[model samples]
Target: MRENLAPVSSQNMAFTDCTKPTDLSTEKKRKNWRNRIGFLLKTNSSESTLHIMKNRSCRPTADDVNQWAQSLDTLLSHKYGKAAFCVFLKSEFCEENIEFWTACEDFRTHTSHKELVSKANSMYEEFIKSEAPKEINLDFHTKNAIVQSLHEPTATSFQSAQRKVYSLMENNSYPRFIHSDLYKELCDAARREGKHIKS
Candidate 1:
């Protein structure tokens, strides 16, 4: 008769390395990183969504720093909606201006009519201070040069003018920056000289 071989007991089965705690922890960290990256990508793609990464108070590894910076670049490249812009502004200028920061955040979180009006007023003031001056120049020759270069009747200039016209049409009913006093005066002077300004 052949020698009988005993069956292996359950306790004698081989131990698997997959069940180790360290391995599980590593897998969990990888999954968390992947999920964070996916969230950043989705937020960057959508204008309505805002991506506020966790504050960098804690010291992060080199890899984490690189990832955060890359995500920020992606977010900036995307077209940010009003809500997202408010959040981004809050994050960017909060330390500089607490009142403005609070107003923006409040507007983003609460859609109250009164709060919106307050936020709009603040934004208007900020816009006037930042953008109004840049739109107008003290030197008339510089302004004329810019206009002439931008409207040379070439394909490139025409395309650029088309974009400007579209932007003005969307923002203002009239294809002009009526808010700027300098622009208004320039138009008046041009009209006096019998020059027609085309959109």
Candidate 2:
């Protein structure tokens, strides 16, 4: 059985310890945030979505792309880098890390309690829950911390979980992304653009 199992990364944990959340005081709040986080805001006929970022089609310059190599923070801070990395992760089916991280980034901007609670519970269901649709690999302690925070649903509710996921991406996903063909294509495009600029 062990041989059949894939090697686990940092956040990907055995979820035999799944449990229910404690703080969602009302059933309404639970249902609202029960929505799954999606990678595509793809149109079939009618599709209204939020939190799912449209992949920025904008290109980055060679210098800008090169900056990403310096650190995970640099890559994430640059809009194109963020978009490109999101694409890369989507290819790997681990877009949840970036999705969760970005969701948390968006989470902090809300000042109203209603907005905070709403987004917090949604994120909890989408990523933190043991069987979440976009379930992210999280440890027991970190998972518990976020679960506890969700009861009150503050802007910082998912901060620790976000940081943990960020670390996982920085260590695991970012390195692979840097080497990925998708990134290489961006670099190639940047190089071509640089040559075009010179001539």
Q: Against the true structure, whose lDDT is highest? A: 2
> Can you give the lDDT of residue 57 in candidate 2?
40
Lowest-sum lDDT 10-residue window in model 2:
33-42
lDDT tens readout by residue for model 2, 26-105:
35332332222122212223332222122224446788888998899999999878877776665555788899889999
| Residue pairs clashing, model 1 | none
Q: State TM-scores per candidate.
A: 0.23, 0.70
Q: After superposition, how far is residue 9 of candidate 1 from its true place, in Å?
A: 85
Best by TM-score: 2
How many pairs collide in each candidate, listed in order?
0, 1
RMSD of each: 31.8, 12.9
- The per-model lDDT (C-alpha) reads 0.29, 0.67
lDDT of 2 at 101: 89
